[model samples]
Target: MEENATDGLPLAGVTVVELCHSVAGPYAGSILADLGADVIKVEAPGTGDYARDWGPPFAHGTSTLFHVLNHNKRGLALDLRDRVTCERLLGFILDHADVVLQNMRPGAIDKLGLGAAALRARKPALITCDLGAYGRSGPLKDRPGYDPLMQAHGGIMSVTGIEGGEPVRVGVSIVDQGAGMWAAMGILAALNKRHVTGQGSHVSTSLFETAIAWMSPHIGGYLSGGAMRRPLGSGVTEIVPHQAFPTSDGYIMVAAGNDNLFRALCGAIGHDFAADARFATNSNRVENRRTLIPLLEDIFRVHASAEWQSRLDAAGVPAAPIENVAQVLASPQTAALGILQQAPDLDLTLAGLPLEFDGVRPRYRHSAPALGQHNDLLSEPIAPEKAAS
Candidate 1:
């Protein structure tokens, strides 16, 4: 077995057994693994993770997306449906794993007798996370859900697209990824609690709940009798001059967050907008957006995006060019952040965790494993203490 290169990472000694597929669960496991958890990803023997085939953009015979989500984890091909295999897994978890993370189909884990309550009953130091679609107890609990379904049912799509246009899904799988983040956070909290109490915990989260949390600002307003927020294209409902405006060459997003910023923006653009009563304050500009935006739009179109960005930066007003994926990837800012990383033994560059410790990002120690690559562990010698415990 290849040794883990995680000596200095926070989770170096933690062990995670991940029985999951697709984005949300795998993403959570990836986060833990990146932070130096010894994550063993157990998949059904033959087909493995469904995400393996989720693309025409394949690399190493699997989807690039799958590789991106599954790196830094060992792979085990064990069919839980097999009686002996299931028992073997249970034994492994009770003996070795500190955490078990899963987003299997609803009711599947309990059906297999591998539910959090079941496992934690045997091993008081074990943590388990259930990343569900709807929730643990709800009408839609048993129904399978994907990212788009949650996005639509959870009301994100209703406020996502252009104003006066049919609602559109956000380009990214925000709900799945957010739910995964929540699951990771809950597990981390449980781990902390375990350290203090010598008892493990069951952490539960769902895509539906994550969606609601993301919609807090909107929901708060609507619950307080504010009208339903309509989509504002690249603009926001509360802030005028906070959207992308067309430039002579492309688009630049201008954000005049306060009256002072608005004044600076006006000065930078050579417009006396601050002197105009209808646009002097943020509230005034918001109230008069219909009039103010069109006038500003005409002025913005006279300059290229680069020219406006320079002016806004010089004036200390917040602004950015509307960059696409390729543009952002090629940017100096992106390079400076060191967020994109290449795996040590693969010809792949992927986005790393969006955080660092002591100014050092976690290393991409290895590529994602091939299916069942570490299945020999079923026969490998278990540490005597681990086995006895």
Candidate 2:
């Protein structure tokens, strides 16, 4: 396709009807929107998306989190149960929408006659994605789920946090966002399939499934007769000397991932660990981690993190100082990447889609729409007979 044909954007001609709220479904819609799709976000008539009120840290009179998840789209507000409203939405989908991304409570969209099977029956080329709680077929599929709940239920919590400490949820909504990315990827693949088959497909994903996927490596080890994995704080079971150690001032993470790097690291620290049989190879290091780590820790504490970073760099060992969010945002690397973007029409700066095409990152066209901001699109609703015709 010509670049001018899509305004230099990949999905410029596609239309997405986003019946989503909170995180997962909206996040998927936002990904498509960033790629230049015409996304219309539908919400409840009076209250809008529940995420709109999710914080005291409001921006433009709504939660910042909502803005982050919902920018670059139009918004429509309607009561889906109303006969006329349902008909109007269905008409819009049949005529204009290429994808329907929804995460309504289990059975709700089906009860409203807007499920994938029903919509595909009307327009076989219409793709639909279902972002659900548990999954579509398990015994607990009907139950509502949140990110933390899935983390706990799907065994992620079992392998997180300090080994003997209380359970800790991952600091971010990893499961929800992962599920959203998966849903978006599935839809993209389905769209490709439609180009040849002239038929749509149902793309389904859930937070619980995403959580389980995050535990894949650990699961593999356990199935291979290894003991159940325990949390190692900042450490991983497979690699030694790969965790953070405290320096005189702060912490620095060192990763001596291979035997050569480990030998280099020992030489940099003026240690003879490479000459010791118990620390000669990666396998030996793993077996002797309980003894070796403390010795490295004592050596690291003699100098500051920066000095250690410089020494490790000179020796060609991978090491870095731990940084928080503020430090990360202020770093030169973050500015150079151009991931932070400003909306063209709003006083909002947000992280853009983490991708580039032909040396150009997707630009933010506009901020998130106000509730019902595009209701005029449905002002002249298509009559049932007229729509069918």
Candidate 3:
């Protein structure tokens, strides 16, 4: 493929019909849009996507979340139960759309006659993705799911907080976003398969599946039916010296993944603990972590976080001060990366896709649309007979 053939957009001629809401489904549409697909978001009549109102932090009178998750797409509002609208959407899919993505409750799309089976039967070339709450086929297939619920049920929260502390949420919607990314990846693979076999595929993922995937390491290790260990909080179970330590001022995260970094870290802190029998190797350190952690803490608290960070950096030890959100956004690295962007109609700065095309990050060609902003696409009234011909 020529670089200029797509006018620099990888998915230039692809069309996506997004039958979705909230964070996960719309985020998948945004991912496609970022790659240059023409994404048309189908929302409910009147109120639109629920996430549009999910805020005290509104931007331009709507939830900033809507702005954050939905960029570079069109919008249309219609109730599928309305036969005319359903047929129009179906007709649009049969005739024009290359991809259709939905995150509705299980069986809801099928009830509306727009499920993968129905749509694929009509347009065998259409790539379809379903983002289910739970998985598509399980005893809990019909169960409604969310990020926090998956975190709890899939054991993420069980291994998240301090050993005796209350279970804590991961502070981000990992399950939803993870499933969305999985859906997008599946769609891309389906598109590739279609290119060769001339047939589409049904790609599906769930928040539950994503949540369990996040526990692969911990859960895999416990396959022998051992009891779940208490949470270590900001530390990895298999690695030692990999947690935040309090300094005289703030805190610094120190990671000595191997023996070399461990030795260097010990040297920088002026500790001969690397020579001590109990802490001679990484495995030995893990076995004696309870004893070693306190000794390291005592040494760390003698210096301020910044001073320790400087020393660790000079010694080539992996270390950094724990930065808050504000500090992170303001850091020089963030500015250099230039992942933030703005479109003309958008009133606020937003983060763009974290990918570069030909060394330039793709800018938002359009901000999130208002409700039914592009309803004119269906103004001519859809005709299925004409599409099939």
Candidate 4:
């Protein structure tokens, strides 16, 4: 198949070498690849990225997680522990790469002699991104990191789930993906700098730091202002009428961010009690949430979710029926937005990038490669004279 014209893709000429495993590092590489970077993912010699095994819902017996995070990239396996092979691989990447991404435990890359200092020495303009569980300088720098553990440690668990239930990890690998996005942003920023100064610098982020940054609003509220947040279970703690309420057919989420919207919500539902002097203000509504919510639920329960949605929309108040993943995927809005696409000749579908440029969006140009699928590319003979040169 012909490569589509990449007229609007931002990183068309960039090349990235991803020596990483699992979601975080590879995810960043995938984003860059989506934006038109040539991302070559270096995997382990045999087992490959560990995410390859993290699935029950596999496509062609490959991990869905791996496929989702690794599209539009090539894979080459190398035995980084083998000094000669490692050196050769590094040499190849240093010769042409613009970015190097790795998620090894703190000292692993250094041990393999591909540390940032060494790579920088070889190619001064090559950006190096090091992602880890805890960053490079802290006491826990050497410790291995994973998303779930970081969620627990970074207080994400504290703000999730029902108030009386067990502290719950997010249903997704949010910490890992957050770290990936942060790392990507840093890499792009460094790239911008490199364009001006012709120098590359180390970019580092950790799962813990990512989670903490994601939780900053709640953390700041609790730590600096003495405002504690409780797990309200699908509800915003300080916002009344922002929780999922039962409708005749199903649950519907409603948000009333201000007085007019609250009034519109009350008017739309024909609930005069919502406008009572006792519940007139947002603060009062929040204070009396136990009373207001049940009343709203009672009113909402009299109508189907669809009816409530129409009524709320007509009132210019924001509302929607609560939807599961299947429902969300099947939503007309999702289809209209072209949020999902299928890979050619593959039984898999994946999300497209959220933004468009010059009326063009990123397309999935290739399926995720199988383990060591591009071994020839890595293992091809380089004559000794070429190697010496």
Candidate 5:
């Protein structure tokens, strides 16, 4: 596809300054960059974003995880602890940026004189987003939070493992990602509000809040019913025959939600299992799930997953073969849907944005930046003494 000036992306001409590091904050900046914003990432002087060292999956000796989250942004290293250099860069960013994003510890930015209140006072229309492990003020506000810690404290670990097994944290950093997404939404909302009111706003999101919000439904259910949720592994609590069933070769996921689908599933498998009084309805199936699951498992185990998938698809039953990351990447559906793209410069392939707008598609303009790669562009033309210290 031909690349236009803003690569046909939606957030064209927007400029964002990101004073953030690691997964949560940088991921938000990457999203803005994906939508065609000019994102400039500010890093510390010597060693940059902490994620740089977080890897065994390194690409060209750099952290692949860091590369993925920081794509399509420019990087500048500055000594923010130095008052002169800090003031110069702050002034420059405040002058040109539409949005400023930070993920520092509470009071850190304000101590540096670059807090939202200070910045907004200088540029009334500049939006600022502050992301943290917890909110700025609270009883536990000073406690440091990371993804795994949040998972444990947020109740996700309580319902993630095998039945009767020790609680397990999710394999991915879901809390960080959730917080990043919420921050992005807030930044966009604040920008829209600025359009009408001609003033900026402070947007704040925390990992603690994100994890709690994610646990609301489970917590609500527990509060209302006085029932403790046990880990069911891949099985859902309220649904029967909805989990992965092993086949001769691999596995397939089948969900028979209603009576019609349940009957159809049984018919498609050449069995009338649904006609049994114990499995005649959704409620019955849920109650006798142990019996129904074993029966379906036995039936499915007779064929390979692909064979069952084709047969079920032909019968208009909703079924899909379980796929790993490699299989998903190789699937024709993935290519046709344009879920992955190659970044020639970085010599890597990445998953693109999960959105489409009015038939317009986003483009990958550049690979993730090298540490402090844009320092020259960001350097202020100040006196030698000012630039020196």
Candidate 6:
């Protein structure tokens, strides 16, 4: 047995049976794994996860997405189409597992007799969570959804891109990853409750719900006033001088959200906008954003983005450079945060949990597993070559 990093940690003895694939479901399992749970990822045999083939840029003959979302888990590839294989999975769940989470489409788990109601009835201490696309009770409950599709349905696309520009998906898988985080939160809550009652709970979240949750403030405002809020191209409502502006070389985001900061920002930029009646207060600046913003834009264009960012930082104003993905990955801040954890066995680097306990963040002890790597541990061993044909 390999050395598990979970010794002396919370959830050291917890076993998670993850019947999930792709980003959302797998990410939830990954979160638990990082917190020291023994997560068993059950993938379909043959192709394993469809995401395994989703890359032209494969790492070690597998999808990078698979690698990122699957660290610290033991992989078990099984052909669930076979009755015996499905039975083996459920047997392990009933006999040993603490939590079960799946993101398979609607009716899929039910048809396989792995529904939450059935599983919970068998093991009252088994926590089961379903990560769905739309929801469990909506008219579109059965409909499948992807990250981009959910983004369009959940109003993220409406407010995401440049003002009046063509609708563009958010660069990251916000809906999928957000839903995953929510699932982990729900499971943790349930686990806490279980400690008291010794009973498991059914938990669920959906991509659509995650997307809508992210847009709640904006949606609430629009719904109340019946006035649509247009995309501000990185600008926020009720705040003037809170957007990215082009400098001599690049763009930098600035936020002088209040009166004092506004005055300070004007001084830093060598402008007298604070004295102008039209830009004196936050309300006035908001009202005359068109006129005042262009003036700042003109002044900002005179200096490089680095110079403006430096001056704004020196003045204690909220400011950041509009860095590209590569710059962000290579930044000192990323190194300082220590978010990246090493996986020497898999020759991979993964982002660790975004939090610390006792001043130490958990590290990845296990790299991602090969298909059916742990299948021998089960009574029925599944082979990756046995694709569901």
- RMSD of each predicted structure: 3.0, 4.2, 4.2, 3.8, 4.2, 3.8
Between candidates 2 and 3, which one is better according to lDDT? 2
- Of candidate 3, the 10-residue stretch with the lowest lDDT total is 380-389
How close is every model to the real structure, measured as TM-score?
0.96, 0.94, 0.94, 0.93, 0.91, 0.94
Candidate 3 wrongly placed segments (more than 4 Å): 1-6, 224-227, 380-389
Residues 1-389 of candidate 1: C-alpha lDDT, one tens digit per residue: 24547778888889999999999999999999899888889999888999999998998788999998998888889989999999988988888899999999898999999999899889989999999999999789898888999999999988888877886999989999999899899989999999999999999999999999989999998999988988888888788889999999999898899999998898898989889998988889988989999999999999898899999999999998877899899999999999999876768899988889999999787778888887776777543112100
User: Which 10-residue span in candidate 1 carries the lowest summed lDDT?
Assistant: 380-389
Window of ten residues with lowest summed lDDT in model 4 = 380-389
Ranking by lDDT: 2, 1, 6, 3, 4, 5
| lDDT of every predicted structure (CA atoms) | 0.88, 0.89, 0.85, 0.83, 0.82, 0.86
lDDT of 4 by residue, 189-299 (tens): 999999999999899999989988988888877887756877788887667778888888888899898887898887898877654877898889888888888777788
Worst 10 residues of 2 by lDDT: 380-389
Candidate 6 structure quality by residue, lDDT tens digits, 139-237:
999998999999999999888877879998989999999999999999999999999999999999999999999999888888888457767888976
* Strongest candidate by TM-score: 1
How many pairs in model 1 have backbone atoms within 3 A of each other, for residues 3 or more apart or on separate chains, i.e. clashes?
0
Which scores greater on lDDT, model 1 or model 3? 1
Q: TM-score of model 4 relative to the true fold?
A: 0.93
**Candidate 1 at 268: error in angstroms?**
0.8
Write candidate 3's Cα lDDT for 316-352 as tens digits: 9888778888898899998999987876565788888
Which is the better candidate, 1 or 3, if ranked by TM-score? Answer: 1
Count clashes in each candidate, considering only residues at least 3 apart in sequence or on different chains: 0, 0, 0, 0, 0, 0
CA displacement after TM-score superposition, residue 186 of candidate 5 (Å): 1.1
